[model samples]
Target: MANPTNFPDLQVPGGRMHDDQELCEHLLRSLDRPALLEILPSKIDLGGTGLFAKEVIPEGTEVFRSIPLLNCIGHEMSEFMCDYCHTSLTNGIDAAGHLRIAGDALPTISRCTQCGVCSYCSKDCQRKAWRKYHKLECPVLGQHPHASAEARALYRLIAMVKQDSLSEQEWRALAYLKAHEEQWSGHLEDLMYYQPQVDNPHRSTPLAFAVAARSAVRGAETLMQPGIDNLQLYGLYFRILTNDMDVAGPLHPNIGRTVDLVGSLMNHSCDPNTFAFFEGRQLRVRSLKPIQAGEEITVSYVDAREGFMMRHDVLWFKYFIDCKCNRCEEEELRISTLMSQESSSFEDFYQAEKELIDIRNEVSRDYKAFRSEDGINQVKTAISTVVSQIFRTQPWPDTLLPMCHMKQILAELSFKLNTNPNQIAIYTLQSCFGITQRSGPHWVYALHSLATHLTPMTAALNRLKNTPPLLLLLALIMRLLAPPAPPATPPDCPATPRQFWDFYNGLLYELVLQSRKTYGTDSACAVALVEKYARARARSSWLGPEERPLPGERGFAERFGEAQVAMLG
Candidate 1:
């Protein structure tokens, strides 16, 4: 018989934090974020801890915000992206509006001396990064540039804690967070595939590389630190596995990752009251619904749109727990309903969906026709037709909307075929009609689809310089179906990300007027449209208008800077 894996102790060095005082205040104080959230320990098996709402909070209200404890850009994409801000450093334009491609005079990214691959946006960014654990990590990365994401995340945490030399209180708080060392030990061989190079200066097992990185800072002190030593490093590895959050950017939603201290207390739920978004290093949590006092404040650990079985499999594999959330319990599990189900309005939607997928796959295989589209008639028409048919029936706030697949195909298709901007505008209007007709007054699927579609739809309409009845109606529908701003920060800022937030929010107020016009004042659809906005790294098809850039026209990175500068002025 195989022996059981030896797991570390669950209790902290001292369990003094069993009292509620050491929750979030000290951790958030540095970021100037208020200690609005609190943690309560649980006796439940899957529920080690849970965060509770302090007061009756309204929808879209900012609840709590905190900076991540450890963060790093993805190893592969570390170059051509700012390590600090995560802005794309791909292309640049001079003050004279002249284009500069790769290897320009003013190089956008500065390569790290120790690790040749590590790149930063500016000197300020590089300096800020040095103070925040990079000083310890430089040598380890230089030795082997291909360290796994998990190892790097752990290395970042170890470096930060050792440099700051964590207080006992901080260590206690960290220990209170969950780790799956026992469960992880089962996959130990799979985990060790990406160890530090054999002859590397930090010449130890992957776990001890963190300690060796700390060697240069202080000799005996590195060995003496009790909070994150070699044993703790093993346990800390699993802690990171359990609690790390995706570090998304303005352009690319997920470019990196970070570990949250206080946010770890917010447990997983299929139906959650709270949502979180990134603002630089800070993580802002907001209420997605009217959370009552003493109610559990939770965020979705996985995309809720995933089918019950798919969601179950994901949660079970990643989290090692079976979800019994209300949604999970309520859903009637069936294969067809999850994947190829038939709605009332369209029995053949799935067939069309299959065609789109096949075309997308074929296009993907083609090295020439990567389908990142701005305005293509064939691509837009096919997508609109297929999407309209899919939601023809049961469109009222349907979570089963094929959002991910639609977004993927719409962004990447071979537009080598004939494309008419006029046809795209027409197809857009057709889809909008289908959106309203199928979804009716209070259909969230239609709203999200239309709002996302508006980027491309509006792009086509703008090219025509004409607002027909259909185009005008599309505008009204957009006003009725836009994303909103967080209650606290009203999103008027120089950053393109925030500007996009404001642009979306400005359309939200008119929802009542348009809703009333379409569905009458008393109907659910006619009432005000209320939605929580988390400055989500969402890709709105309408946000970026695409056509082949003019010879002097800005590229993606240049255009982002252009848009932000335009907003600033």
Candidate 2:
């Protein structure tokens, strides 16, 4: 059998190299490699069995860091009050020391010493708002009393502008308002009631309020902030409130809020390649395996069990786009009724529900067995079985299985593996593909299964490329199969052993090709890997003209040749 190519050696301090097959062995030897502090110029390479980083990332190398763009103090309350102090308001307020009525009666108001919008009872609170941005916005409060919720939210934002980093537009808007105090003094009766009968019936209340606020700032071009395109800013702001209000519930008081834009961009994939988590105000994105550059970053928004139709509905609602990704395609193929049938009776859906419940029960039993006996292998086998059963009974078998139950299983496995890090490999597969860290281990295991098994199935699916379902499955399989490679190898470490190189390259090649077929070469993952492969081939002294193939040219025969040879030998 041809020896596998050498895996690249990473430059991280205290790091060592091992063969690809010895990944289990190396993992057993060392648990945690080192903490990543910063993103390196070169991406990390994961094709090899062993993990490696290019430079010696210190113990606290910040792998990811981001400050909150928008922060809310008390967002969780059923109703939003003043943006500054967060006090509940009885009714909206007007400039003439009079309160505005919500329905018929006047609503309560909080008064700010520096600015009326601050709405704080105490002088100290007034002082804080003044320092933030209220000094600029105080004079203009009377201009737009019935602004939209989003517009009012924008006003609170202006009042909080303590930083000098205000864009030119924002400063001008502020300055313009200060100059034209007389223009905003009168109680414009037209402003008392909203314009009746608009196109968007649902938007009347909020839109009316927003239009009033915009009217107040209309002439004050100077006050507009730079890069503060009102529409986009307003859109982002609204998106944040819609998604995060529940999570930032009133009980947990926070000064900052985070929105996962990247996570949001990742339209749903039945077999997703990435997972996300929130740390304080920051969103952390991690690859379950080596994620290739340029692939569309994705997250599994729905539970793995949801059949194709159910998953599609939820995804369409949240993302507002039709999902044509790989997993969706597979579900279409495996379950003929998945896309066409709408459940008319609860009993009609009951059979599918029963299958899921049975699978869940069996998984739980397997988890208990693994826990009681400390049998890692047994646990792995049981997990594999449970996963297979779940897949077979899935509402959309073509897509990846639902993640909820799998997440549960993976969590238990993680707990068991806490004492044995070598078991990390088993978990690592799932971690790379199954569930976000928030979902835990069962999802991770399922991810592993998808990445390992389903990804390869794309080749078979390609024959049916014209079919929408097959095309979608191909796209998903590509993402799960091929992820980004880790950063370059360090100079001091030995070159990646042949055995390791062959294993990693073969797996990566297969994944890359399938991904190309499904997601197209333009996909973020495919493009990233193609670039890396080009660079690697360029740098390699061993590749002669005959040995090298053009990008995406290495067929399965060449890529997986060593693996097959080894098995036969």
Candidate 3:
């Protein structure tokens, strides 16, 4: 365990330094974020902390950009990514479920020769990683090559502490996070005695914790300044699980998990004002909506697009938090109102609620058991079952949340199968609708982008079934996907078999405009969108008609109205 007596500057958690607003400022200063944000006691979480905006923060303003304090790539993805810089080794798999060949222009990833366990994109990154913490870790990882990503992350954190690689401020920030040791220990005991199957795979049992901790200690203990016991290690593990964020990027959505000082301090909300996005391994949080001065800066820990019940249950089970956010309160009232209006009797409502929950469980079980090698028919059957069981229930509107949850799984399965673009579009569209109806269009734009890909000018445009709805959806998606400002100079257009320059111009142009609003005109997202717009413009200049949408597709309002009618059916 860390000894505060050795370092007089470091105060224990729950001490005056942690509770005092003045001393906390010094800790927040270490983050070097915008002065517009401050750490404050949260009204939302009783006796918990939160981040607040010190000044009015406009939409699209960059709140902060953080390089991870600690991060690790998942074991399954270690082969594909550089363990040092977290860069992709290959172009990754294409839409057809085949691995895409990396072009000669890209840098090649190389494995470390000593241990052959970690990979690096360049020699510089390799040396830097070794100097940072990998000098001690490589041997351990080499011996236990099959260690889980979480265990590896914890091991790396411990190695950093032993080597004094982290600054005093960084160490203090991490130690300040709550471990929930008592609550988690009780939960583990309950799981051991009562449950045969683990509800969450990431959760640790007493036996598993002992084995992981012993293995880590055996390899790294020799190097420690102040050694830690199993109890202290278990406490750290609980803290890691509670505060970690999924490290996702544009290229790879599920790369790994990371924990950082500033990012973890932000609390969860069902309807958050800010959203985090990534550029390589660096995380940048931007305001989704304008935030007023003194307002709490919150982000959704779970996907806000998810139905209320799913969000509520996950929060309660994992964080031990019963969310009483405004959104949850409204949703609760809405559900009650809906039940009273739609239900013929209390008994009917109970039966419908029971049926909905049962269907969710059944889908969840089968979905987990499903493997890529399995037939697509099983997934299709699950989708059908969810729809038939819940979509026509007595209070079907109340069941939309679970219905959407099931559709989310179906959309993911469709993407994995990579067999039918049409199915992908349909499932993605349904999934997006479920989100847009509740959270708003911004949350569902990524899903909509998947569907929009099917309607590219080069695709078989005439073969599309719901042309108006599809076209409208594509237009809306492109509009949302675009950044604010376009490039000053158009990029050269690449040759295609058949060029629909007009469609390309409209789609890419919308993407550029939307990007400017969502991300700043100078942001990486906006810059990338501008480059794409340039190519479309270069092509449209000579090869096609004036910038126009597909034939007979109306403006957004009309299209949205038509789409709503079509979607409800």
Which candidate ranks first by TM-score, i.e. highest?
3
Better of 1 and 3 by TM-score: 3
lDDT of each: 0.49, 0.37, 0.58
Model 3 CA deviation exceeding 4 Å by range: 1-23, 89-104, 111-118, 143-148, 188-226, 251-253, 332-374, 391-422, 437-448, 455-507, 537-569
Model 1 Cα lDDT, one tens digit per residue, 1-569: 02112223446654433354544456545443332445566423344666666668776456776666666777656877666655454323322323343465754776787777578867988888788668876776676576656667666656666466345555567777777666556544443453453335222133333333233223312422424345455676667767776664311335566777777777787677765555445666656568887777787666554445555655665567678877677653332453344443222533554555555445444525543343344555665676666545443222343334344334323213224333333333333333322322223333433444444433444454332223222333322223231222222332333333333433332343443333333322223232212122123324454233421234534543443343432
| Every model's TM-score | 0.58, 0.30, 0.72
- The CA lDDT at 299 in model 2 is 49
Better of 2 and 3 by TM-score: 3
Quick one: best lDDT, which candidate?
Answer: 3
User: Can you write out model 3's per-residue Cα lDDT over 347-439, one digit (the tens) per residue?
Assistant: 454444445556555555565455353645665564465445433555244235555555556666656556555455555555555554322
Cα displacement (angstroms), candidate 1, residue 518, comes to 24
Looking at model 2, residue 259 earns an lDDT score of 34
